[model samples]
Target chain A: MHILIIGAAGMVGRKLTAKLLTTGHLGGTPIQRMDLVDVIPPHEPQSEIDIHCEAADLSTPHTAPALIARRPDVIFHLAAIVSGEAEADFDKGYRINLDGTRALFEAIRHTQSYCPRVVFASSIAVVGAPLPYPIPDDFHCTPLTSYGTQKAICELLLADYTRRGILDGVGLRLPTICIRPGAPNKAASGFFSGILREPLVGKDAVLPVPDTIRHWHASPRSAVGFMLHAASMDTAAIGPRRNLSMPGVSATVAEQIEALRRIAGDTAVKLIRRVPDPAITAMCEGWAPGFEASRARALGFRAESDFTQIIKAHIEDELEGVQ
Target chain B: MHILIIGAAGMVGRKLTAKLLTTGHLGGTPIQRMDLVDVIPPHEPQSEIDIHCEAADLSTPHTAPALIARRPDVIFHLAAIVSGEAEADFDKGYRINLDGTRALFEAIRHTQSYCPRVVFASSIAVVGAPLPYPIPDDFHCTPLTSYGTQKAICELLLADYTRRGILDGVGLRLPTICIRPGAPNKAASGFFSGILREPLVGKDAVLPVPDTIRHWHASPRSAVGFMLHAASMDTAAIGPRRNLSMPGVSATVAEQIEALRRIAGDTAVKLIRRVPDPAITAMCEGWAPGFEASRARALGFRAESDFTQIIKAHIEDELEGVQ
Candidate 1:
């Protein structure tokens, strides 16, 4: 099977790439050729399969058509401008996130007699504050930021394109990846991972919000799993609603701290420094606390059920099981 | 107040224009100037207020900027490719419905220190079948048609632009306008109006769906009322959720027939011909049956309570009480 992975240099994209390479196949079909694309050329992973890494801006005219000319059987669209940057620069956000995605869909449609399975990486940012305790799968999208709006719009486009029989598509509303395998960042939701990742690695991480603050989360491993499931699963069962809220562990700051303590002792727990940032706290208020994700669950997409399991998955995947 | 109506030549637009001209003011502000724009030049209404009629395609590059250059205080965006045409022609649908709307919003944003109250005419087609009996204010948008998709996407843009302080926007998800004045068209939803309208004029109308089929509806006057309310009301109460489902009368075809019988007697009701087209019947099953519209009702947007009142509205407004 041939495949194309956009935004292959991003964290989730990289992880998904590594997993795909390790398996050497997807859904019982052997991987023959793959193209990895992003704004910056993705790293060329060593593999027996034919792998092409190229840098391309999707919003640029003709870029999408050139990429689509090869007619990859499955296209994994993981590209996006992050929430913070998208909100800061409105024009850039709409250009790369909204127009870029639309251009890609248009390219696919223009290619006569060619319909690929498109797996889109949507986000929980699509819905904002005034949310219910556990957001249902069918909750309306009222995103508070430009980034979320772009994603929500893209989801509508994906479903419409799918309904027209131009392309088979599925949009995964991925939860905020917890214990993210990266350095500290200024992203408001970064603290959700930072508070745990830093303490586990013998580094101090700032806690911007109170321990009572709850949020939805899943390990990066589960996110990759969701991507694989989306690409290979029978889309007929999904019907017209192409977008779905993915399942994840719903935990408060206190619960996350407790999970860290259980894994690495009080020493790791003490590494967390409480320095309240009112700005970040206010932002978190509008963030999704949790989701019902009943549809995703019923469709066989699984995730870590609790905080401890999430921590274990992170340790096993990123820490080489040494932690 | 200076006002611009983008689709001033269309049915709802004509009605809204007539209402505005009759009042000679909006929100206590005396009529100053008005711009009526459409693909075809709108008929210039004989009014004391300054009025300009122009034939312009919004999808054209400079059309939106030229309109926004005037910087009307209240912009009623009622332009769209009807559902049937949008479904039949893909490129034209996206061009006129999606890109045109975006260009208008972009033009508004680029204009320095100018934020108009944008009253966008959205539709209940944003939601599809497998719907709740009374779809609530927060039901997810899963549009089944390209026109619906365009409206849904525009709704997202309206909310995002509003949140960013670029424009003060309100989107009204208008129900199907019943007793729509004019000759019966071939639109699947046209029958909803046709069954009542043609009979009221002593003409026979075809019913393509069973009497058991129910749908949501509002009169053209109420639709105009919703637009006025959306433009003049204090948007502070709306907060971040800029789009709303307007309240409307919900009735089964049987109920509609019964109402017709009450108003025009059994003879008029007998003018309805039952010739079920399987194609339309299948489409009707996926249409919205009703909506709670609690938020719109609470905000004082009103509509006909029952089919009888709806027919009465048609008589009073269109037939001059002669029917």
Candidate 2:
């Protein structure tokens, strides 16, 4: 199988790449070659199969078509500007998130007879405020943020393009990656992971919101799983609604800390400092707390059931069980 | 106040223009100038206010920017390829509907200081089948047709642009327009109007679907009312959900014929011939039967309460009370 990964330098993309390499197969077929593209040059993974990596900005005219010209059998589109950056820079957000995605889809359509399996990285941000707890699968996407709006529009395009037989596409609306394996970033969602990931490593991490603030989450491991499953699953089952809200664990900040405490002891929990920021707090209020992702679950996608599993997965994957 | 009407040659656009001329004011301000554009040149309405009409395709590059250069206070954007045409011609549909709308919004954004009230003509086609009767406002748009997909995408853009403060946009998801005046065209929706219109005027009209098939509808007069109301209504009242499912009458084909019988006699009803075309039947199956347009209703937008009123309004508006 010839595979292509866009935004392959990103965290989940890298994880997915590692997983694919370890398996050496996709959808029961042996890997023959792989292609990767991102704004920053992706590291060329050590694999027996022919592999190529290139740096490309998809929003630029002709970039997407050039990437698609290789015509890989499977394409994983994981490129996007993060929510914080997207919200701060409107032009850049729409350009990369919306225009770039549309350009890729258009390029795929231009190939005429070639219809590859396309897996898109959508986000939970697509669902906005005044949401019912455990948001149903059919809930309308009324995103409160620019990033969410861009992702929602792409989801629409994905479904439309798939319906038109232009390409076989599946969009996975990934929940916030819990216990994210990196230094805390400026993303508002960073706190969700920082409080847990930082504490385990004996680093003090600021809690930006109250312990009562609940949000949906999945580990980076689960995110990779969601993408691989989406890449291979029977899309005929999904029909015209090509997007699915991937299953995830719903937890409050308190629950997340408790999960960390259970795994890493009270000393770790002590490292979490409470210093509320009203801007982040207000923004979190409009985010989805939970979801009834019955459709995705029924379609055979799985995730960590609780925060403890998410934290444990992070330790095994990121910390190499050092803690 | 300066006014711009895109697709001014369309049925609803022309009616809106006529209505505006008669009223001579909008949003409690005296009319100043009116600028109209369409693929076909709009008729320069006889009015005391300055009026200019031009033939232009909004999808073309530089067209929208040139139109926005005048900086109209209110813009009524009603341009689009209808359902059947859009379905048959995918590239044209995206070009005219999606790209055109985006270009116009981009033009407005480029103006920097100007934020006009933009009333967009969306459609109930945004919603697809396996739907709930009296479709709720919160229902997720999963359009089954290309036209619906285009309109839904534009609605997302409208909301996003409005939120960014580039324009004050109100998108009305108009139900299928009943009793459309003038010649019967090849539009899939043409039969809905033809069955009522041609028969009332003592001409035989083919019924493409069974009488049991129900659909949502509003009069052309009501559609015009919706545009005017959307233009003048308080945008602040709508919050972030910029689009609304407009109020309309929901009736089965049998119910529609009965209303016609009541208004124009049994002779008018007899003129309807049952010629069930499978293509139309399949198309109508995916359409919404009704809508719980409580949002628009609460906003003081009104429509005919029943099919009888719809028929009467058509007669008074189109037939000049002769019927």
What DockQ do the predictions score, one after another?
0.96, 0.78
Docking class of 1: high
The list of candidate 1 runs beyond 4 A from truth reads none
lDDT of 1 by residue, B76-163 (tens): 9999999999999999999999999999999999999999999999999999878998999989999999999999999999999999
Global lDDT of each candidate: 0.94, 0.92
| Per-prediction interface RMSD in Å | 0.5, 0.9
Could you give candidate 1's per-residue lDDT for residues A145-234 as a string of tens digits?
A: 899999999999999999999899999999999978878888889989988888888999899899999899999999999999999999
Highest lDDT model number: 1
The alpha-carbon lDDT assigned to residue B304 of candidate 1 equals: 90
Candidate 2 Cα misplacement greater than 4 A, ranges: none
B34, model 2: CA deviation in Å?
0.5
True contacts kept of each: 1.00, 0.67
Name the TM-score of candidate 2: 0.98
Minimal lDDT window, size 10, model 2 chain A? A179-188
Which residue pairs overlap in candidate 2's backbone?
A: none
